[model samples]
Target: MEKESGSMKSSSQTRTEGSKEFEFTARDFERVRALIYKKAGIALAESKQEMVYSRLARRLRATGISSFVTYLDRLEQGSGETEEWEAFTNALTTNLTSFFRESHHFPILAEHLKKVKEPIEIWCSAASTGEEPYSIAMTACEAFNTLTPPVRIIATDIDTNVLNTGANGVYSIDRLDKMSPERARRFFLRGKGAREGQVRVRPELRQMISFKQVNLLADNWGVSGPFDVIFCRNVMIYFDKPTQGKILDRFAPLMKPDGLLFAGHSENFLYVCDEFKLRGKTVYELDPDRKTSSAKLRRA
Candidate 1:
């Protein structure tokens, strides 16, 4: 009992040194920012310290660690380090998304499909929770007016938890609030009995997508592509310019020369990447001239 009491006191001292509520310091915040940038290419801002503390504080408590520093140390040099890193990466990833987000893009996608005579391949590089990829499937169906459209979509993200959610293809009924009633009736089935207040994507739509956990910053994506279109939306805001440039460089090799790239409303890639030219609202087309220039530069 005496030894247990001493151990309890030591734990209390450790917590007091880096108290749960207010002990996250500037240095600690910088360390976290650096680590996340290195691991995931997410360039967190100084303003995000509170968010980091709130998100990671739960981790420290779950691990029974007293302070952020100690938790970080354990993360850096510990058994099960891979799992811990996955947890850390998952904790920091922001996965805010909704069905048919940026509705204008769908019409453009439909038109683009009309011009293609062959099978089309697409990549949704930041398909959070499955909404965007499923939306792509829906648009393809609408464009082709068929149950089994010839569109192949690869939807990927770094969060395994969300990938599972996306793969399951089930969502709360409230998720359909923003979607049109016709679309809701067409693409999703209302759950019944024990599954009330939920909906599942119809098998037709689910089969159109292949969901996987992919970290965009990783060395190899393992995805063979000459994709006709790539949807990488609302993700560049979290990365620095150099990281964004590197991603674009990698994307150039995976896309066909005439392929389209759709971006989020707030992301403007005009200055970040020269290989894609702004074609329309938040839409980019591969720049033939820049492609030639890149080839020349590589040879030189």
Candidate 2:
């Protein structure tokens, strides 16, 4: 039976009689694509048309706008633009990550920690929902055999929503599946009573991290670096080569001489940037000589 009360459900959300579907034209899509790229360095392909329509349709509903064209007009005319733009960018951003998603990198990080006798600072450039930064904290704790290990992590992302989540340091119990039980016990506190089946990052682990919302394409990252390790994984795949190269160039000066840069498995910087040499699988270090390291150069 159809509901008697009307709600602002998206038109494309479901198929029903007499409900007007939002008109999304090719011109509208192109306009949106252009706007997104200009605001954020993300390149949206033609195939993302449906996705664009679906994501923005909800925005239309919320704003009580009838069509995509009207919304686009409002957005471009600079009327209540700041909040709309923030919503637009947040809606389009993609963040998929898990605890120890790239399992191998953690061990390498641990080894890097062991070798570095001085203080260590790490920048997690795509900290989606806190797992990656918390994992870094756990690894540091294990490597140093202390809760108060001397390490600092700056976790940043363009999405304000996810940064808030990361700062909260809370997760469903199942988020720990990929992690070993021992490590989970060490770093997370299991919730009780009303919060059962959830875990929160232990105070010690939370203390090591600072979460912030940062757009990587911006002129200033707002965080001091010269970091020992930078986890910029699974983020560059969305950008074109030129954008990737520029970001890499910006990253080079912010890291130590032997600092490590971790890339996504699908990302290969060999063709894009000369500032970093591939030190291991998806791992890179600054290459002052600009000579590409051979694949035979094994991981330490």
- The 10-residue segment with the lowest total lDDT in model 2: 291-300
Q: What's the TM for model 2?
A: 0.88
Would you list the clashing residue pairs of candidate 2?
A: none
* TM-score of each candidate structure, all chains considered together: 0.89, 0.88
Q: How much is the lDDT of residue 214 in candidate 1?
A: 84
Q: Taking the tens digit of each residue's C-alpha lDDT, what string does model 2 give over 1-300?
A: 144233335443544323436988789999998888877888998999888888998999999999888899988888567888888888898889898888889899999998875789999999988888988888899899999888999999988889898999989999988778898888889999999999999988888999987888888778777688999998888888999998887787777777899998999998888888888999998896742332222211
Distance from true location, Cα of 148 in model 1, Å: 0.9
Regions of candidate 2 where Cα sits further than 4 Å from its true position: 1-20, 290-300
Model 1, 190-284: lDDT tens per residue?
Answer: 99999999999999989989997788889878687777899999999999999999898778767766778999999989899888889999999
Worst 10 residues of 1 by lDDT: 291-300
* Model 1 ranges with Cα > 4 A deviation: 1-22, 291-300
